[model samples]
Target: MAYKELIGSFDEVRNYIREFFIYGIKKRSDFSDKSGRTYDNRRRQIESWLDGYMSFQQSASGKAQIISVDSREVVHNPLYKAFKTKNFSDYDILLHFCILDMLAGGKELAFRNIAGELQEYGFSGEENVINERTIRLKLQEYEKLGILKVRTEGKKKQYYSLSADAVDLVSWQDAIEFFSETEPMGVVGSFLLDRKELAGCQSNFWYKHHYMLHAIDSEIVETILEGIAEKKYLELVTSGKKHSEEKIKLYPIKLYVSTQNGREYVLGHVSGASGLDFIRVDRIKKVKTGIRCGEYQKFENEYQASKSYLWGVSSGNAKDITHIEMTVRAAEGEEFIVRRLEREKRNGHVYKITDQQYKYVVDTYDAMELMPWIRTFMGRIEKLESSNPQLKKKFDQDMEQLYSMYFGEAQNDIS
Candidate 1:
């Protein structure tokens, strides 16, 4: 017998995967976004799906529940089943069968044709609102997905069933393995490998920071991307540090994802702004299409030029550029250190001073954004000079604080 677990919304499943599995080891209150009743329902649903894989541990403060899957014990990722068991409504199931049955006779039908057929076939029950609009929307979606092909002749448009694009296991084997391990939403790719007789690939990634919600928000990402593709303006309702419940119009530029932390951001600018701006997708409360981005090329060019000055996402006005230079003392066997600096330095230059020394330099819009990374090479950092004196002070202050925190005022006495 198949276990049918019900979910209230996609958000419920999202909360489960985010709270218990991806970033597990979380307390009950960690899910403050949802009501207590809603949270409990999701927890129960997750337990039903994962079954034995879910477990709880008692901490000093509270109990923390998590999904415990040992690769050596479990044959496959347990979460794969979670994706398969999406809660579909009775209407959804009926619509699926109806769409196929109507299209089965090698017939080409318009939205109206399909909807009329469904009406005659009697899909609507006592209280159902399965109207022509609903049926038409479904058929149009099917066409887009390549499940149905559309033909346009003279002034009329018609659609018929077309074979969907199928994947070949032989060619996608390695690509699947690497994707499953490294990328977010790789579970879908991994799920494809399971469809083949080969089962899952041997490769597995032990993700320390799995921002799995990015996959769920692929809809938002895709919508924004489509808007960009059409060169359209975006209306964003964003709540973050600078803005609170603020609604604004933005020109679509590009999306940025942090490799260090798997957070996604959209980079764009509001009207009459001298500098580029960024908004976190997670922080975005709502998004809508505004107008056609007729001047997108201008913003696109600005975005390209802005890239050179960005050490991170933080960028200043068009003219603001801060130059920073650092001398590093690399030990005898750590030549890889120099190589590391060069490879990771975006829009930066690394020059070899001698056998044991190197100079790393970069010009960025905001030097403040680059300081955290600069602090990483604390011991080896020599003559940390910046075009911005304030940034230099902050860096020196941070270094001093670190020294005092660890070594204490004894180091101050030595200085």
Candidate 2:
């Protein structure tokens, strides 16, 4: 047989095995009726090939052993139940698994090698193609989380096995455990599952804390997003414990994600607010269509211009931009801070912070909404500066007074 023909035959056999594992089949004999030499020859070939494959997998340092379902007892865990109930798709999970399988043995396979193996596994189709960059990013994420270590050898790359503690599976139980701890709810959990690169078993602590879905009704949120895309105006009532009594008018434009809280907020032009205002969808009550938004075209320029300073979607009407500066002392091993600063610089922002210490200035219209972020950096922040000297003095005095109040209370209690 030609080499190409042999490769094709082996691929077909591998596919059959995958199908067999996914669907319980007793044996290849269950489907074949040709007895004697023909049956025995094919069976022996398959068995030998499978044994060799399993051997290769076992010897690979970072390889996850493919579990034989028939030999193992499958548990009906909550994670599994949720995955089944949701009918979640695992295409991305499978793709990553295949890549990990190929990159086993601490080998730094080329992007072409990874992509070719995926193609051989029937992952690539005319309409569905996976790019090299996507694979590189997924591998990078694994490396960052300590699941895999990546090394470059003058263009050719290799990945080393980093202890197996971070490895995870893609079944329903594993999905549940991953999401329950990472995403607190189904909306974000479903979104996470949809991304093939992100569906891996490894977990990132910062990602879990920053990718949370806010307390918004998924269906209603989708409707709001659709409405914004279609350029329709909405009359909605705020319905949370705090905003229940408030009625508001809004022209929905953009959806904003809060990095600190992992919550999603809607940013649009509120009728009464001076500029763009952000409202949490979870807090929105009776939302109804009001106008067709024919005259709202004029606001597009203002909206487009405001996006530069609109961090987390709450754009205020402060023409005087505040130059609030703070220095952050990143914890040891926290190189993500440097990456974040680089990203900010790429986006045309002035990020003068380094790996050890960083400084940033945000032009926030409503300073109150930025307080939570300030609190997060309280432990790490050593220096605070403002463009306006008077404002700086006032901020300093406020901090001093606040600290003094807490300190005085502590002394009184001690006495």
Candidate 3:
């Protein structure tokens, strides 16, 4: 069965237990023999699956350590009994221990680097392997639990380190005894304890940012990301009015988030195009990597300046600079409007107006694209005016219709 199917069955079995207990209480009788046997079997199956899962995790973690041998053992010892008796499932404990071990390795690793190391360690098996995606998720959970500290290294890189005072929790002897008792049962339990003692040394080393695009299948997107990291140029077919059958080469500088959707797009320059261009990955048909991009430094200042005028990811053709404005009211419980507006301004946009009643603004692009944000504050705001006369008229008409439908003296009276 698929992993998801197994997970569904496990949840169903757990639900059955809750239902069975409820029915037993209602009937004022003990569970039937058959029902009791079924519950026991299902519980056993879940435990077995959990054991297998943990063993795989431990094995993968060990392999990762072996590959990154630069890690030194931590000096502070953690209490093994404290961790073992905490009611954490065997899988949870194994995952926790693996993360601790990684953090103890003396170097801060990025999420992708940790995932890649896990993959390399041969923890993934044919039927019940732990995938890198799952490992990344588990790492996040560990961070939330305060076992690790996650901090951003750059825009895309997140580094993980051991939490303060993590080493003082348990002693080396306690860890050894706990491992000895649990090791014979499963791979996860055995491997963790086999090391004799927990590593306690702390060091200051950080991993490089390696962006791994997960959902995109476009080769062009992959080529572009890889090219940017390697400082290389790429040749691709143009999609806009300057469409050409011939492939054009350009140096990739940075990635921008698409305004329409949260999808990523490449912001680069065309070799002979008049100005900087934005190309959608899905629109490009072909891509070829070229030599290192030595000219990227020259465009850094220009890119920084252009960011303020950008509407979403598209800088909107280098020549067309359309100024946009909109009015939005802050909803009753939505005091976050001011903070959000401040954040936008901090990112380099103009904050035209901020007052008690509503917010008005002049931004670099069309306000229609920001309509969703405006709608979120519907009851709070009223349409005022737009820099472009046509856009202002449309917004005024839309707001009037919305007001007629939902606005009333009675609606304001309740609050």
Candidate 4:
């Protein structure tokens, strides 16, 4: 009911940030599901996290505010700050520290002993006494998180903090600092970097094409990854402009990160569907892991076999493969163009047809996805062909329009 920087539900915050701050611009009244006060509070929360990147404008709909960030410029994701602000109760905090303290110095205790020790601290929240049930619950939670390890002694269970050799922060500081700023689960590295031993550690790296938005999508990505690791089917809840909650069931195969835009996707085989398709991480609202997939290996093998034909995420038109060939002329000094083609032509081949002429060929599930990359060689392209006549026609029409726009109808021939 009241405004606070700390959030209770990340899903609710993620939805507001994606819909209003990251994806589109909208007036405050556009949110029909929530009251104006709620909208204002959510907006303020996001603005606080994205302090320098936010901007406001007077639009036809009304005055609107948006988070405008150039992904290439930022060294780290500001959105990670929102995730760090989760609210915790006084009892939860006290119990966490108490447990760690009790289990410190290689001390191990049975459940009853741990509960007795916790009671000795006189811990209470909201006037309720901290009972054995609460202490047991906290221990269970920590055991699942690997913070505590449990062992059975006959019929009784003993719990102790999981200990490991201390990492040499001096030796690994740079790597951890770099990972914290750039990796998908960099937030984990960030937590490590925050330890008091590394208080003065700083990152010496920066990315030319840093994508800051993925931090917001990391939670869902982590869930999908868990399903993938366990070889389980995932029941996903996806939302879009037209569809608020479209449920999908899939055998998740792999997580794909786009090199072009840094967006993340999950390549999975939909239940009862024929082939693997990619689901963009941002579209996912919730991921509920389902039953263990008995045929996970079968689908993974199928994806590996079919992935060669994938130019992009499109699994292309239900098994209809398209072939494309193009000839391009690059003058003697433009060897860089040839190298560029060789570097970017995924699943495609390039060979010199002549001193100045080169031929590029590939088979793909969807040739349409390659159009943008093909257009980059407009002036150098001498000939082009596609097995899908519609695709060729679309490319020809687009080239013709470009020629007409720049050179007039008299010089409408792009070839």
lDDT of 3 by residue, 1-415 (tens): 2221133222244333223321122111233546655545544443443332211112322311001111124121111121232234445556666667766867788887776666544455784377666677787887886767888967978998887764432444454434333222122332344343433322122323211111222334557778888878898765444433457788787766543343456788777665567766545556779888777776666677676666565465444455554455555576687666666442334243545544445555444555555455556555445465655555556666656677642232121
In order of TM-score, best first, we have 4, 1, 2, 3
- In order, the Cα lDDT scores of the candidates are 0.71, 0.53, 0.51, 0.82
Query: Candidate 4 lDDT, tens digit per residue, 330-377?
Result: 999999989989999989799999999999999899889999898899
Residue 80, candidate 3: alpha-carbon lDDT: 17
Model 1 misplacement above 4 A: 1-87, 94-136, 153-159, 164-166, 180-213, 240-244, 272-274, 318-320, 331-333, 394-415
TM-score of 1: 0.73
Ranked by lDDT, the better of candidates 1 and 3 is: 1
State which candidate, 3 or 4, has the greater lDDT. Answer: 4
Q: Number of backbone collisions per candidate, in order?
A: 0, 6, 14, 0
Instruction: Give the range of the ten consecutive residues with the poorest summed lDDT in model 2.
Output: 74-83
lDDT assessment of candidate 1:
0.71
Our model 2 lands, by Cα RMSD against the true structure, at 21.3
Best by lDDT: 4
TM-score winner among the candidates?
Answer: 4
> Which lDDT tens digits does candidate 1 get at residues 1-415?
2434765445446545664565664577766664777667667777887798877778787888877766555434566566666667776788878888777767666666777777666666777657666676776777776678877756876655655446677676777765654454456565677765447446443545444446555545666787778888888776545434778788878788887766888888787776678878766656777779778888899888778888777867655888889899899999888887987888888998888889998899888888777878888886788889988788767777878888774244321
Clashes of 3: 14
TM of each candidate vs. truth: 0.73, 0.41, 0.41, 0.89
- Model 4 C-alpha lDDT versus the unseen true structure: 0.82
Give the C-alpha miss distance for residue 388 in model 2, angstroms: 5.8
